[model samples]
Target: MRSIVIIGGGIAGAATALAAAKAGLSPVVFEAHPASGEDIGAFLTLAPNGFAALRELGVADAVAAAAFPMTELSVLARTGEVVASRPTSDSFTLRRAELCRVLQTEAIGRGIPLHHGKRLVTVREDEDGVTAEFADGESVRGDLLVGADGLRSAVRGLLDDSVVPRYAGQRVFYGHTAKAAPSEPGRMVMVRGSSVAFGYTVSPARETYWFGRTHGDELSPAEMAAPGWRDHLVELLRDDATPAAEIVAATAEPLLVTNTWDLPAVPRWRTGRVVLVGDAAHAASPATGQGASMAVEDAIVLAKALRDTANPLEVYERLRRPRAEANVAASARMTAGATDTVPRVGSARRPADGAVERMLAWDAVLED
Candidate 1:
């Protein structure tokens, strides 16, 4: 049996572990954080494509139970005019931490060994197998090593030094509030303000989850740590006659803001027995909202490749690189404000069309 060593215990890593196990491979997960629920500040939408991938992995229902459904996406202009509204294709919103917890739980229940605080420090690869050395002075050897360690991936560096994360030309802010403007359940609203792009959705419990993005220089550490971000965001929305200002003003918690970052392209995704997955390979800006979904897709496709082919790494890259890099390009355009339409909640378009759906279908045999 082939043994897989996976780095990073976030969505991509955990999902990969499950998929690999289903493919009859022995997989172990190493997480940098001490425990689950480390990054709960930000939330994301899992599109139909992502859920479809989870279904293939046999965890869709578990994820759905922890998420709030979003059925429609409505866009408003600066003058508060309804510009566009469309139905989303089976989209659900959940906090990042919640999604990670759900995936970890599902992985654990399946008896996959997941080690926390095992930050990888070095990777050694050879013709026979590969070894991963963690920060805690423990090391493990496996037939293959998968890096789902995200944008700042240590594994990616071992593959190619040219690929580095770049700013996507925007500063993103996230906040939640119960006192915001009344919203219809199952609907996500996007406000195209004069200066900022804002979106919000009310949870089943009636708490509003909202995010705003503005194109500017990246915030310094001092500016990000300083208070009064709520006031700053409210001021940016003051001139627009929309609910964004009121929603932001009513936010009681300190808003979390960070510079949007992505990798436009990677020169290499695999070297020897080590391969990259998810954001470690192809990261897109949040403007497209397909990061998590794309990661899930990667998980499924990778396991299929490994199960069906002798040269799994080469075949996996050929199958995944095109779609993943396209998403990166699309997100770059959206973050640069090149398009007027806010990418709908699920995908820029229904990426889960017939071909993609067939690709994600677990029973379908992968073609070499």
Candidate 2:
């Protein structure tokens, strides 16, 4: 009952492999991509809770070394007037590719075999264990199977065809520019423009990372990969007096665009020897910026559950559902423009008695 099979080599999969290894379980990763550096253009900020989880997995320092700090966040109105300014302690920003490479490298260093280009095709479970068949005609047997594939997960579809990712009513665009704005060394600026929610931060290397969300029709894959999103986004921000328009106009790199998607709830998270984690189980919109953070937290908790309990899947779902769903609901609210308050990353069921802190503590024993 020690061998574990992990599907998907994204952030969730790699992180989970590390967590499982740390918990004394034998785990291997199967990634659909040919390499670890897909989605290199996109970037995200990892909150403190994410770092807490990474610390538990013994990879925080490695991950942090590839990221730059984000010390403050400032919110602005459409008129470019400052609405709120607050410090965001212990937050770091880095490319999505860098994060994946760091985690995968760490997992390989720990002797966890990661097989790329192995796409999961089907799963068969017996009374003893589960066997996963890949598209490349390879198969592996393990005592437990974990699905960390992501929003459009093959495992989720196989588990229950009804569970699918839905659009969250907005199209998000991300871009980078060498042209500097009026940004501080470690401050992120968010502008609530007339038709777009925009945010930008300057990296230590003087590149500006910015993203904008606009209410619009869902884009086709061809449209998303097209080269005109920068001009379209600039036009959307033209009316606002904020720096969003100028920053976007200065971007020379191809702008990345995609429809925002989320799963408010997954009717079932597990069955027998199979369980889901990260976006595969509960994916939230990017409105709250907690997707990666919540995913890392999932890895830590799921590993702890496996380490401490007989019913690892049930125990892991029981401990994780509430917080993960809270993030989904909050992100939905923000994406729908249902709230006027500034979006917060961790507005979930975080108790004041240090419960979440304890949950991520590697030395702390988990009680089922």
Candidate 3:
């Protein structure tokens, strides 16, 4: 049996381990976090493509139970007028922590060993296998090494020194609130105006998740205080006449801020017996909303490639590179279109309509 060592225990790493196990490969996962469920935020959207991959890995139902199915996505102008209403058909908004729990449970059930606090520091590959050196003075060897380690991937650095992360010049604030009974669930609302965008999504448990983004370098410590930053977002959304005013007004605490970043286009993603997957291979800006979906797809496709061929390096690169590259290009386009200021909202029409569907419709299960 081929033994595989997967780095990182995020959604991508967890899914990769599950896929490897189902393919009859012995897979062990190493996570920097001390536990499986840690550092994940309030909500994330899992489109049809990601759900399909989860179903193939036998954990779709578990994840679905933790999510609220979304029926429609409405894009609105600053004045609260709907510009476009796209039928979601199949999508869910769930807590990132809950999704991680479901994937981790399935991975553990498969008897896949997961080691926490095993931060990867270096990787060395050869014709026979690959070896991963961890920060804790521990090392592991396997027939193949998969880097699901995320955007700042040590494996990616080992593979290519030219790859670097670039800031997308946007900062995001995210938080969750209890859902009111009269509130509609399973609807994703996006309000875009000026240089700001606010997204609202409700989960099955009646919890509403909110995220607001704006182009900026960084927020000072004083700017992050409750009254300053919180009030700033309130004013931004209020100026746009967003419908969730009561929800935003009720929050007394400051929202958590995250800086959006992505990698510039890289020429290659594989080296020797070591291969990169998920954000480690192609990190996308949050504007595209394809980060999680791409990661899930990467896990499924990489496992299939490894299972179908004896030349792990060649087959993995041949089958995975094209798909990852296409996703990277699509994400770059979406990010550029959304962030660019074109005066008239109609200029942004093409991107807001079909970008999501095009990403969710990709069939990563099919081999090239």
> How many residue pairs clash in all the candidates, one count each?
0, 0, 0
lDDT for 356 in candidate 3 is 30
Query: Which should have the higher lDDT, number 1 or number 2?
Result: 1
What's the distance in Å from true for residue 238, model 1?
0.7
Question: How does candidate 2 score on lDDT?
Answer: 0.87
Candidate 3 stretches greater than 4 Å from native = 179-183, 218-227, 338-368
TM-score of 3: 0.86
Over the stretch 74-192, how does candidate 3's per-residue lDDT look in tens digits? 77677768887766745777767778788888888879998899988898877788889989999999988888899888888888878888877678777777744233677687767
Query: Residue 262: error of model 2 in Å?
Result: 0.7
Instruction: Give the range of the ten consecutive residues with the poorest summed lDDT in model 2.
Output: 338-347
In model 3, residue pairs whose N, Cα or C atoms come closer than 3 Å (at least 3 residues apart or on different chains), thus clashing, are none
lDDT of each prediction vs. the true structure? 0.88, 0.87, 0.72
Q: List the residue pairs that clash in candidate 1.
A: none
Q: Which ranking of candidates, highest lDDT first?
A: 1, 2, 3
Candidate 2 residue 281 C-alpha distance from true site, Å: 0.2
Error of 3 at 234 (Å): 1.2
Query: Which of candidates 2 and 3 reaches a greater TM-score?
Result: 2
TM-score of 1: 0.96
Residue-wise lDDT of candidate 2 within 1-368, one digit each (tens)? 58889999889999999989989999999999998888878898888788778878888899889999889989999888999998887788898889999999999998999999998999999999999999879899999899999998998888998987889998988888887788887788888788788889998778899888888888899988888778888898999888989999999857888899999779989999899999999999888888888888889888888898887888888888988998899889889883234566433458899888888787888886
